[model samples]
Target: MVAPMGIRLSPLGAAVFCLLAVGVIYHLYAGVISNRYAAFRGRTSVDLRDLLAVSVEAAVLGGKEVKAVRDENHLEEKSKGKTREGASEPLTKGDLQSHVKMYNLLKSSFPGVTVNSEEHDNLEDEVTWSRQIPDDILAKVEGGKLVPANRVTVWIDPLDATQEYTENLLKYVTTMVCVAVDGKPMIGVIHQPFTGFTAWGFVGQGSNMQRRSSYSTNPPNVIVSRSHPGQVESYVRSAFGNGTTVILAGGAGYKVLSLLDMPSSTSGDMDKGDAYIHITFIKKWDICAGAALLNAIGGEMTTLRGGRIDYSASPLNTGGLVASIGVDHRALVDRLPEWDPERH
Candidate 1:
């Protein structure tokens, strides 16, 4: 064994020792420090909450930017043909260029993050999972396991309700983000750019509402998509027994907000009334954010036949969906025609 040398340290030595000790301590508690920082920023996922906030701001601003430029160029009429179903606008000429540009910029920051956006379909870019589902939620999923970050996926609708937006129906347009692990949506964000209203929710952490409102009406208001208002009338009649009023609305996210009964009035005293049902066969991006909101508030959003949607399975929800704020979900689902998963 080597004998200890009794060499005394100078002042500089003590300072260096203190610095090294502090560094080690910080390193030991690095996770705690990181958690605190996440909390301070009102975030939990490695890059989710902050990414959503930034993406939303960019989308909102981009909408305005695009609209302003459209007006200046008098391209509104010229763009009409492009908005139709199964049509494409020549990107080389009159592209709504800002939408993809803003989305790509926001997405690029999170290297290797898998994303399913309305503007692009690139499955190869899906990244590994870097975050775990919260304990409370994870406990409920039978044998649910957290995989690598590369398996995680995010769905985005940078500008939902494109037709409504082009028609100048500003309230209907929204920006949406949904985070899924394996094939389940665990977090969602919905932002209405024009109103600057936002709703967000995570699996176990609950939800946040920029505007809070309650459901207090008896008859229960039902909102339907403007594009497909008549599709669910019979279902509504069957579910509510012919007394509920159907309100034609645009955008799945906006309609979900209505179901939340958030007050839209400036006075802030008006009652939004109660909402009981929203049913549609829209895309995953259209309803994923809404599902998060409904789930947080103890509401239910399931396939039209009342089946759980696996977000990772497919972007198109051919089976349709029924979401509700108040009522027995299973009972309502049972009321529909004989459930057929294959037909959805």
Candidate 2:
């Protein structure tokens, strides 16, 4: 003998259960199924101009984090030791905080795109961000239409010149972001937290900053890193005579800004160099944004051997970098001695 069990539900209860089931199903589709289907089919196209605008916002957000850490006097240093080339690698709380902010902003804005950041620790953070683009940034968009999300790569430097930042040289600190499409850097945004100055550029479109009116390479006022001078000074001297002015500075972003006609308040009296040269090993995150900016304003940034640096390649750039505006880049490359990994 078998006993049969029967279940009964009221109309209201039945309706409520149905509604809950519908909600669960809807969430499942929206959160998981939809995304999987999208991936299976193809990623939706993203506008480069919109991406640039978002990158600018991300950079500004990172700069705010940096400034907040410094203003709060939380400049705690976490020594990353030295690189293979013997250059000091300094990390700070500001770097981590800024990196988290920038990484979140970019990932949230475009989930499918690849984001490469300078700081790689404590990356799992949940943050909400608004998708609204600033009116000023929106107005600058022109001609850059939709492109596949997978074809883009973003490089971020949350805090450049940590050593100088630790020394309280606030003017040299910058947070930068770059958008590279199809392995080519197409957009750059650099923000100086201390000065509240931001410069953005879109290659082939235009830039908010202008070239230095006095920018020239006649005597080649070259900017070299203060932290890692290496043999760059001697190379510059050999390339453009001993009398050529060599400006020692901190931060690749600041050096690139020196090449631009920025306000004296932001640039200070550092004798804005017409060219920026670095011989030692440098990370792509350190230089990608500056390279994009230079490319936007009819400037050139390439290896000392005058070969294009592919953004999608390895993060480390062993080849020396040289950036110049309002001058013949190839001519400058020709003057510099051939880059030898073993020698200068």
Q: Assess each prediction's global lDDT (C-alpha) against the native.
A: 0.59, 0.86
Model 1, 15-73: lDDT tens digits are 99999999999999998989886565442234444444444454454455445544565
Model 2 alpha-carbon miss at residue 68, Å:
1.4
Superposed on all Cα atoms, model 2 deviates from the true structure by an RMSD in Å of 6.2
TM-score of each: 0.65, 0.86
- Find the candidate with the highest TM-score and give its number: 2
What is the TM-score of candidate 2?
0.86
lDDT of 1 at 151: 51
What value of lDDT does candidate 2 attain over all alpha carbons? 0.86
Q: What is the lDDT of residue 169 in candidate 2?
A: 89
Q: Evaluated with lDDT, which candidate comes out highest?
A: 2
Which residue pairs in candidate 2 collide?
none
